[model samples]
Target: MKKIVSVAVSAALALSLAACSSKEKASSDKESSKDPVTISFASWTLGTEKEQNLERLMIKAFEEKNPDIKVKIDESISTSDWNGTLSAAASGGKMPDVFALPQIPLALSNNWLMDITKMTEKDKDFAKISKAVRDSATYNGKVYAVPYAQHFLGYFVNKDLFNDANLDYPEYGPSLQEFTDAVKKVTNINKGIAGLNNPFSISDWYPAAANKDMGWYTYKDGQYSLDSKEFIKGVNLAKEFATNGYTYETLTDEQKANFKGENPEEVWLQGGVAVKWDGTWAAPQDASFDWDFIGIPGGRTVVTNDFVGISKSSKHPEEAYKFAKWMSFGKEGFMKRMKIADEKGKMMNTLPVSTDKDVLDEFFSIQDVPGIRTAYDNLDNAIVEPVKIIPGYVDARFEGQTGVKAGDNENATVGQLMDSFVKGDLKVEDYAKQLDQMADQKTKEAMDSLNK
Candidate 1:
């Protein structure tokens, strides 16, 4: 009986211990489940303390909405070295969960971007984004990045200068002829004020301006149309303005020396130039005189976008996608960002990519810059800037892509050829065909290498 009792007691004690272990495991798991998953985010735009603080607020707002996730901001990356840093991180299998993309083609080619096509397709809010922005993020029929902000390149007109020249302020959508005429009328070499600061930007603006169907840098249908008549027109137009005394570039050395400002480079700020070819972000806030922004000479404008993408190496891809969306085109996030900006009495530098009515209303309410709203209202007709989107553009443009003879050399890059053409050493009609072929071939080579 004693042995029996001892055995029974031992068995009961063992069962009790097992039950306690089970209970402890259940409790531990419950506690662990409450721990939030952490993800990392990086951006070159957040270099300044104020910008980082704003990003922190954005992160805070995001955390409030997503208590189950935590974000870690990586501030070590900067614009100059982001590509190299990302390349190293990717090779090490330690890329940040989400980060800004400087070049979509580079990210895509290196497999740094997580495929977000399904997420984007199912996202109702994403569907509300502008087509131009959506197209910019898509590559090879797949979405890789989300547009964070868009900066429109347009004319910043000094209204006072226009008045001084006795010319009416050009409207939102001025024709090329009208633009040319305004430049002529506003020019007064005697007063040391040129009509347009420089016509160099016309090279960037004219392709789309001349033909709304063409993309910036003469990109269209996955090919470059550098030889298109529209491109030739734009190049010739730039030459016309540059050679004439209408532009600051063509001003005589004596004229520059006699300019009103101590710094002739500051002519635009001194209200000496009538129409300054610049981006929407360049709109001055504390100008001594009135100014307004308008679209490029043609109906279309060049819109450059900043993008954010999730890393392919991310462990928490879904979570990273959520954060990326929040940082980019998510309507709710934009509303929160606007609220934060308003509370801080700060102005947003770039426009929201969201096309949702509520988001636009919120953005316009806080954006008080003159003529900016009008310019943004016409974003439907805007063209995407090519350098950010086109693969190998930097190489094909700056570095020599073809061995074709150009400008007293056996090989020349498109930039070199353009330099020769603009300086009147080469004719566009003679070299447009070769430029088109070279640009297309270089782009194809880049794409082929990426595929391999």
Candidate 2:
């Protein structure tokens, strides 16, 4: 028998959904046509203490609405382990009925989750959903999941830092040269500070380095396309940042410690860093500093979907679907989450996956964040983050990119990295060949699974 219990969202407990809810379950005698069911989900954003509390409260509200259904949400810590967990769950019989999936077509092609094409066809709001997001979730003409939010990449500037340097704040969208000049004008390494420190790590840089349309990474045929011209440009920019002292390619232990001690954004907040390129979520406020946002140069915006899908092994597939739908589209579920996050001083960070006019207005107005609004306004030019969808492809790509750690080639330029990859220096195929090959392999993998 499945376990039945209640724990408060406030009580100290394991971060996983296995913990009980504290909210009082609504007393309802009316029984559903089916037995009670547990729908599990893993939250990618539930890492911080604030996120944990918010996640629990929102989940409890969902349970209260649907008295007949019990929802169990687990917060996964290691993003690296998340895919493995989902794959293992699918292979075993314990996969959560409702869970998160990358909002990429390659991921949807894995065939381990529920399909949402019919739902899309029936919902009038589907017309409002962004084509980029829908296309990212659709594979072979079938929509497999619902996206919860959309995120974009941009430069989060420190208003104080710019002011201290006597530099004018950037407008809505600035060119690469303009951005670089700002970084140079404000940077001062002798003061144990920088104009900006965009993470040199793979996760932080790849999206911006990708093509403005297809992104830096794409797995289409059976290969990869990390060496495209757009990708090279991104790399060059990264190289320039390091060489120009805007970023630290290699931080000493002491420097790293110093960086940790001074919140980089606080550094900007206090007139240290001039700009920080990252997701829309990194804004930090200060009484002494003024800050504003601008779109990244080249009109580049990397939009990714945080999505929900039903597991094939789910015992309550219908209930799971309903819960996932509620989480994405249901009132007081997703919209409430955006409001709560914003009120808590977090970025009302994510753009709604739905096209609800009211929800968009509510979210954007609530936060008044610039980079996010810019992305939404220019979503027509946004491209999905390139991710490999063949079950193990992400792992492979992660290995390859991460193995070539940032700044490993201090003497080499970003152009060199691209040229090396382009010339098959890494034994990866040429750009076009790689994309076509990966796409073919993905198609074959999806077909192979059906025959099984």
Candidate 3:
């Protein structure tokens, strides 16, 4: 009886051991099925609601197609505060898997980005991307970033208004005053037409032949001068533009209401305004007006979207590469993204930076939109706006440093400081002096950071 009980216990133990081995083998096989990866991405911003939505949808689609990978988004750093945010992340040694490179060269030199040249070469979509875009992402003989889009900002004008006023359309070359005078002459609000659309205010939109030389930024070398006599002329030109009923603040309550909605640029599309200064992307495709655009007066600045780079800190570098490639190289994936914007009835304003024959074919397949060809032409002298392009410069801007109460009214702020002189509350010389002081302060701050 004792032997029989011991044998029975041993048999049960063997059965339990067999069950454990099978469970372990099944777990190992599941783990080996596919390597799972989760990557974190950061950018200054995804921009408008449509843009934010587009990213979410794109990520969802990517994950659906590639189930082994997942993406986490971190957009807490506004472009205005991107430099500081990135610095803090670096200090914590917890940088994102992918991020923006506002200072591309600085990031590359610091080993913050990884070289993805081999992966890019292997990707089918990379083969179709535009050389200009691919070149921007290349650093030190290696591809460190992914070029997404090219954008252009300038003036979109109503051809009918120019014709009605017997004024020649603003094209290649025109003095700032020439443009302002034309806007004034065309203004006849009683006739239900505004000579210009200054919905956002009247600062950089005023084209100054002088700005062609100033180039918007005060780089470290300091060869350019905001206090230069030429620059003052440009600032005064902006003031004159406001004085001539060219600003949106001068519009009636009824006219103002037309632009209160989210997409106010549509007011121009309705044929109520003759001139609007905005990014070329604001121009809608289905507008029923006769419109054309000219590059911003200086034509020196070119607008491009922030580039995507892989973080050196990324543990899943290959997976991060796959993420970047999926977004850029996979045409169908991107086309799916564009479809979201299309459904939202928004102008993408960004042209594809890929020369891939199929992608270009897909891009142009959409009915040709106006101002796009012109925006491309403007890219000939592509450059950057110091205040808009560079991250820290805004904190140093006149109005940005000093709040609205400094010299602004409730109606507008973009040109309100300049408007103060136009309204005779201030002197042009004082305005110029104020600008000089601001520029000097900014330069000093920039210099200190560089020395550090």
The most accurate candidate by TM-score is 1
Order the candidates by TM-score, highest first: 1, 2, 3
lDDT of 2 by residue, 1-452 (tens): 12223344323345533333322222222333456666777767555555556556567667888887887666532477877777676666667677766634434445677666876787666657777777766666787777766666667666666666677766656665676677777776776567666534322334443434344344333344554554445545555565455664334555544442355545455555666666655555443566666656556556756777776567776677667666665544667777667666544445576657687788767667766666677776666654523344444333223323223554443333344443224322224344334444544564465445
The predicted structure with the larger TM-score, 2 or 3, is 2
Clash-forming residue pairs, model 1: none
Candidate 1's residue-wise lDDT over 1-452, tens digit each? 99999999999999999999999999999977888999999987664655556666788889999999999887655567999988888887778999998889989888898889999889998998778778888877899988887787888888887776567978776898899898888887878778888876677678877776787778777687888888888888878877777888667788876466655347778877788887777777777988777778765756788888898888998999888778778888888888887898666756877778788777777666646676667778878777777887876566754565666777777677776666566788898887788778888988887678
Predicted candidate 3 versus true structure: per-residue lDDT over 239-344, tens digit per residue:
6655555655555576566443333455577776777777656764566767766655544434555577888888999888877766655677667656766786
Name the candidate that leads on lDDT: 1
lDDT of 3 at 10: 94
Q: Model 1 segments beyond 4 Å from truth?
A: 1-33, 48-52, 75-78, 262-265, 401-412
